[model samples]
Target: MRLLAFALLSLWACGCAPALSTFQPAHVADKGHVQAELGLDVSVPTGAIASVVDAGVVLANIAESRELTEGERLTLFEAGGALALNPPSVTPHIGVGYTALDRWELNLRYTGSALRLGTRYQLLKRAKHGVDLTAGAGVGRYVIDLPVGSILGLVELEDFTRWQIDLPIQIGTAGTWYRVWGGPRLMFTTFDTALVVDLPAFTGYPGERELASFSGTGLYVGGQAGVALGYKHVFLGFELTLAEIFSSGELAVLGERAVAVDLDSFIIYPSIGLMLEF
Candidate 1:
């Protein structure tokens, strides 16, 4: 009985004893494996920043922020030429942008900014191949130029507000290190016009005669796709998207007579970007 107890104690000590973190052992499984990841994405100029941050916050919130926060994050996690994604994770993004005048009376020619927050949740927590999905939201703003032929003040220009929502469907490959993701975006926009010369605070037009005022709004839809290249300590990837915006608004100019102006336009823009995981 004493010999058996000694044998059991030795086995326990050997099995439970921890190894030095930097130490790597030779194994059929390769002594390298990643447990978590963080990614930064930039491509779409206007809303990229907000989108990335949103994704990252989500991943952090759900999975307890495994991303190295040491003020510097990792970009990829790889092993045997594949990625490492245990179950739950977070991804963040940021970007900048510029708009320009086009075929419409209401054209834009200015810079804008963006960001995002996102996260992934695993449905089957213990399986090597599981179903994980992600979601994020963000906001952006830009300045637009009007065809009224004046550029002196803010009144001659309009304000364009944009909102973003992202949803990603991710699936782990069968007994592999790669995961696939795809989703569509629902975007919203509002164009606000200002009164030139601060017309009486609430007066609708530039003059007391109340000739006309212009305004507009647009809605856009688009899709994006990407793959997560996971390494044991980092991740690397990229994505591309194409979006089309449709808008219409009313405009009026008056001195003594009343005339009506209608403005309509369609805008198409495409973007591409890269991401690093830490």
Candidate 2:
């Protein structure tokens, strides 16, 4: 995915000069000017931890010894340990955003899906360089899982999703070429799960939907860098971001268990977008 993102961005960013320059058709470029920011932010994290999963797919594709065709039968167990290391999961995402900068220069941003909504206010803003602070919170569902074995019973894993809250604080520089930011966010959960052996049966466990569960929360810090170009009413930009998602939860299953499973992750995503400002 990182390879694909890099490739795609290179094409767009390289071809964007004229497009960026033409995006401010009505802007008179003066005091009390009002503008709106409408863009899509997509993040994809590909650090060492993520590579572990990606390499598994590459090796498996090679070992399969056959040309992999779309719609063809492909089984993880058949592919070997490589497939085992990777989980059947879709990346978490948020989209649909709108922002407005009033004549007084106050900025407001709203970004998220229907399941959750995140709103941020720029406590400070400056076109050249200045601090822009944001605070946001929302509710969502997640879970903690333990290893499965002959005993936690049928190891028939299930019941591991819970309601939760996400509170993130962000501080960045407001700029046209780029903006750099770093801050910590707090995560809190309504329930908790803990210690035991992670047996071979659950070595590649992503999560057992059937196992009733809860995950403890932790604090996280991350940063984002963004660049934009505009010509007339058309504008283009991209952002690279990374966040340390921390959550440590332990669990005992069947007759086995595991402790302090790294429920934390680092992710990156690059996105392209178009916006019209008034």
Candidate with best TM-score: 2
Global lDDT of each candidate = 0.27, 0.35
TM-score of each: 0.37, 0.44
Please give the lDDT score at residue 90 for candidate 2: 22
lDDT of 2 by residue, 135-234 (tens): 5555544322312311111112233333446555555543343434445535444334322212222334432222222244443355544555656444
Say what the RMSD of model 2 is.
12.0
User: Model 2 off-target regions past 4 Å?
Assistant: 1-114, 127-214, 231-234, 254-258, 275-278
How far residue 112's Cα lies from its native spot in candidate 1, in Å, is 4.0
Poorest lDDT segment (10 consecutive residues) of candidate 2: 16-25
**Which portions of model 1 show Cα errors greater than 4 Å?**
1-111, 114-129, 139-179, 194-214, 228-236, 252-270
Tell me the tens digit of each residue's lDDT in model 1 across 1-278. Answer: 43453343223222111000000000011122212222232222123222322333333232232323311111110000000000011113232111111110111111112223322233332243353333333343432222232211112223323333333333223124343454564555444343232122233333221222334454555555555454443334444444443434333333221222222222222222232222
**What TM value does model 2 have?**
0.44
